[model samples]
Target: MSNGDGSAVRSYHDRTKHSPASVRASRHALDWANQPLAFKIYETLEPIALPRELPPIDVPALEAIARIESSTANECVPDLPTLTQLLYYSAGITRRITHPGGEIYYRAAACTGALYHIDLYLVCGDLPALAAGVYHFGPQDRALRRLRPGDHRRTLIEATGDEAATAAAPVILVCASTYWRNAWKYQARAYRHCFWDAGTLLANLLAVAAARTVPARVVAGFVDRAVERLLDLDPGREAAIALVPLGHTRDRPGPAPDAPPLGLRTVPLSAHEVDYPAICAAHLASSLETPEQVRAWHGQTPRPVAPAPTGPLTPLTPLLGATAPRDAIDRVILRRGSTREFGRVPIGLAAFATTLERATRGVPADFLDPPGASLNDLYLIVNAVDGLRAGAYVFHRERAALELLQEGDFRRDAGYLGLGQDIPADASADVFLLADLAPVLARYGDRGYRAAALEAGIIGGKLYLAAYAHRLGASGLTFFDDDVTSFFSPHAREKSVLFLVALGMSARRAQVVPSA
Candidate 1:
């Protein structure tokens, strides 16, 4: 891959893409004997146990999924219990399936292939029940292991260009990805999955924070090396992807002490690791090097091109209060799972409309200026729905309507675009998020690639919750990137594929969280 240029970014994207010929010609098989460890375990640290007695979030799942920011007016800081809830629901283990070989631990969010590659770390000042420190959240035991023992938020404040949220935040959450853990299955494309999996987890994180009335905002722009250094991460194996500043504070941290290396030890993920140079090169190309560069990188959100309605337009009628489901956020997340096999059943148009409406409302991130602006446009292949025609369509977010792009059944094409996956063909509807990367890369630079994929995953995560609320099923699927754009073109000629999500009825019921 080329170095330090936009073409290098495109090189990684194009090389990792799935196509008909590439899928058939490749001989990449799973190495079951050397599968990576599920958890990133520290061998020499003591675990500070978190509270097992958790509080219930009573906010309705639908209500919280649509909300972008907290409604609280006065300043509030999360206590030990509130902090516990945030970590537990977002990534903590909620259920275990006992197999003959051993057990499979399922987390709060659905990850690609159940690998659980994403990890969360908390950096905060002195709180009511906790001391100032940098800590790693261990889901295996529902406890935190301190990595450094002093206030390090000042370092983060500077890393994020002293952004308003990070400066005022009392607690911040940093999400990072260990390449080998996910790359064991995905190989080079694991770089993309890094943001996709984190986006899904952020969905859970943001929703739980909102239900608890804690102000949480996602910061994607930062001095990458600065954050990696604060978290004591090795750029080779693990690197920071996103940050969430939780709660507001008038108080600010003074200068942080010099971070001498802790040199902590951890269990090995596998006996041998395969190095993918493209992943590192792509990350380096996108990474911001200094505060000055970080400040200049962000600007106005890219406006999408919404052509005039070329066909029939059906305005979305999402269910409102008193008519929508009242299930709490906890219940929805606990029941959520990636649908293994989608049944060819027709769901109500209202249910489909509601999911799209709530999930695309907005993402609370720095890249999306003015709150509700989005980088991607939604194009869909509707196969089964009660009130809507079975055809190709594009969703107009501002107008809240689905404009028919073409009137026909494309079940075969749906499966093809999804890389010959049955889930897309058999599902009620398939949504492909396409982005005009020229503007995204031009505006946000190579890092914009990360932002576009991240935003798609966040919205994709919300779609998961929204679908579950209506008793429907949802799954994130891989695609043949160029093929998708071609299928949705003339209109999408300049656009590129970012993500795909399928929604339908489930073939079998998903496992639920066992009661205590």
Candidate 2:
């Protein structure tokens, strides 16, 4: 596959697909001794202490997740405290667990294997109690370490071809990923996790921004080299995945001063690291080289509308007029964790419908045209839901209904599709997010894969929050890609599974100490 061509991403996806035979044939084993550290540490930089005692936004979790658009008013700039709260609720370390091995720092968002490979950086103009500069978010210490001084939002604006959101934004959050941190466990597939993890983080960011009335939008179209250079990131190791413009401003900053090389030091991830060339190749293949290319990639091609449902379509009972969950976004995120075991108890149909309705409302992203359009379709295997029959169904986001695909218990089938995990088999519902890759790849080239997977991850993240807000449990799981498509064939014959999230009642309470 040619570099910068969409082929590289397509090749990687086809190569990394999970199958029953592939799983059985593989002899991969975890190397506990060589496990990478969950947090990225910068050695020389002094931490810029952020406010730990943040006042929580009062927006209900359900209402927050359902917000589709960001505030457009220019006066809605986020001050230091608001920015601090946004970062904390989005990617900050929320819980600490002590074990014989030592401490495990779990973050605000759900990550694959709890391996927090994704890192956050801040670029902004001066704000109340904060200076204009480039800074890295150290979730371990809950502080920001300045990497460079002076405003640098213009660099991002240029990289994004003067994207409207980035141009008017007072602060921009850059999401990057360190390959080896997650690759230690997932290997080449860790490439996909880069966007998946970022998507999950953005899920929190967008929701929190909405709750706080801060303008925010995910910017995926940007010159790859430009962003990496601005962040001083090694493209081969840590690369920028997405840029999110936070808050709003009528004034645009002047041209950025030349960004010189900064040879900053970072603590080693582990005693040793493994390199996966496939991951790097896939990234390079989908990367946009020029600002013009970035501009062209801004909008997504319109998806073909689905035909009317011929089967029995059950209208969704969304919690629109019903009272929303009282738990605020921060409290919900602090309590959220991947369910280790499901109770197999049936969740009320209203709760299930609320989760689906709220999560799929849509995301404000660059790849999605018209802002709120989604790139993936949602399919579900209903194991147990009060008032819902045990069967398979595809969600109609537009119509707000479920089109019955098959009527039968798919407990075993769900388990098999989820790489033989009991989580899906035992959960109340397993949402399989699938996309037709052909059109996606054709439209955005190889990068569309990232957009599709990222969209699924964002929605999956929302599902996690919605489930937890209602005092239920939710976990994101991997699946046998082809099998998932096969299980939902006819309706999803051409689509490929991008992400899976299982939701249900928890079997036991998780033990986690709140972060100080």
Candidate 3:
């Protein structure tokens, strides 16, 4: 198998070395205005109206992926209420705040600059209330707009090279991101935001599924053109990032009839658009044109092997205990948001350990650190954890213990690493995910770039769930790429920081009680 050493990957890797080019000269600024819309709308197809009144079933809060207790692939056939709940929890509006400009709505997950680029689409066979068709999830209205009417999972089956789970699934969810939405703020790096935002959202969706007993698996490998065409998307502006096959069904996929080209229009998100050439270039470079390419892309490789312990493995006996009583996702999400302000309080070391252990048990994925291992490393700045000295530590998953690296009051340093954010200094601990990119990129190519970010974001998402389950607070943050690894020194020299999450007790408690 050829490594993702293609010119596309090489160009991307080279671009990373060069200093930031002038924004004036960047194609992202000029070319974006003329680029085609991300999705191809079908004017002929009527919109499939989704259920407004969603299910009232309260979903249990799942703290850890390993602690997920469902084995059955059977789902509840998602009535209007269940579907509404899924949509709301997955990408629905949780909060709206008024500002000088106007009002800004925040979703269930954290996004870069709050510039939401990721969009959700649902394709399913005829179910109890809904029909067999492809529909677009509109978080704006909390409804689904029908794109095409029929069982469209077959296109996914073909795109995924007939992956068994996708082929047998009842409903498949597709996640796509429009570049300009996030690129306006992040510039070329909007490409990275695509996966990061998607992973954070998927974290919610997956947890919701676990709570609802829906078996879902994320499929990153697929024929790019097929999916792009099925969604009527222009390859240059937007593309499919990931696919989730929801609910196991013995019923096989029906034959995929030809989907004709669609030319529909959508309201422009913003007046002016900015294009990132490097993002477009890298995306095109890593794109798989044929199903054969997708098949050959995933060559069998030996899973990662953990090295023998070099020193004493700290046993985390105090952390293990029964998880919090199942809290509903609706309540958790309503209470969830990025912590802009944090109060310096000492959280119990047991609570910290439990949160880490529960969150990192393992995310169900084909490309993972190992069967039970993860792709990213968890490093933390212990500002204040009861019974644990304030310092920097590396979480040893195998031993379920945090190995002390440097012991000191590094609140100031923690803030600096988190791009000089106040929350890091105020929080009890800052969790950073570090990874050896060379191996991951080698095994999975440029696509591995997506995997690493997604894995970190998913874990970060779980961290949010874990914190909220214990009535704590958490927030996703960004950091200086090289500085994070530098702060952790010799131990994390080769590793690069993928994502950051700050966890602790909230400074202010909400007075209003959540509805039952």
Q: Give the TM-score of candidate 3.
A: 0.88
RMSD of 3: 4.5
List, residue by residue over 1-516, the lDDT tens digit for candidate 2.
222446778789989999988888888899998888888898999999999899968888899988987658557679988988888988998878899978878789999999999999999998888889999999888899998889899999989999999999999999999999999999999998998889889999989999998888888889888889888998779889899998888888987878898988888888998899999888888888888888888875558788789778889887764565678888999999999898767888888999999999889888888756888999999998888889999999999899899999999999899999999998989999998888888888888888898888999999999999988899999999888998998899989888999998887632231111
Could you tell me which residue pairs clash in candidate 2?
Answer: none
Candidate 1: 10-residue stretch with minimal lDDT: 507-516
- Each prediction's whole-model lDDT (CA): 0.88, 0.88, 0.73
Query: Which regions of candidate 2 are displaced past 4 Å?
Result: 1-5, 509-516
| Candidate 3, 210-275: lDDT as tens digits | 767777777787877789888878777887988888777777767866778766677766566656
Where model 3 places Cα greater than 4 Å from the true spot, the runs are: 1-3, 6-49, 56-59, 63-69, 72-77, 97-101, 299-314, 317-325, 369-371, 509-516
Q: What is the lDDT of residue 259 in candidate 1?
A: 88
Give per-model TM-scores. Answer: 0.97, 0.97, 0.88
Residues 311-404, candidate 1: write the lDDT tens digits. 7999999999979888899999988888879777788888888999999999989899989999988999999988889999989999999999
- Residue-pair clashes per prediction, in order, are 0, 0, 7
Model 1 residue pairs with clashes: none
Error of 2 at 443 (Å): 1.2
Residue 432 lDDT (model 2)? 94
Q: How does candidate 2 fare on TM-score?
A: 0.97
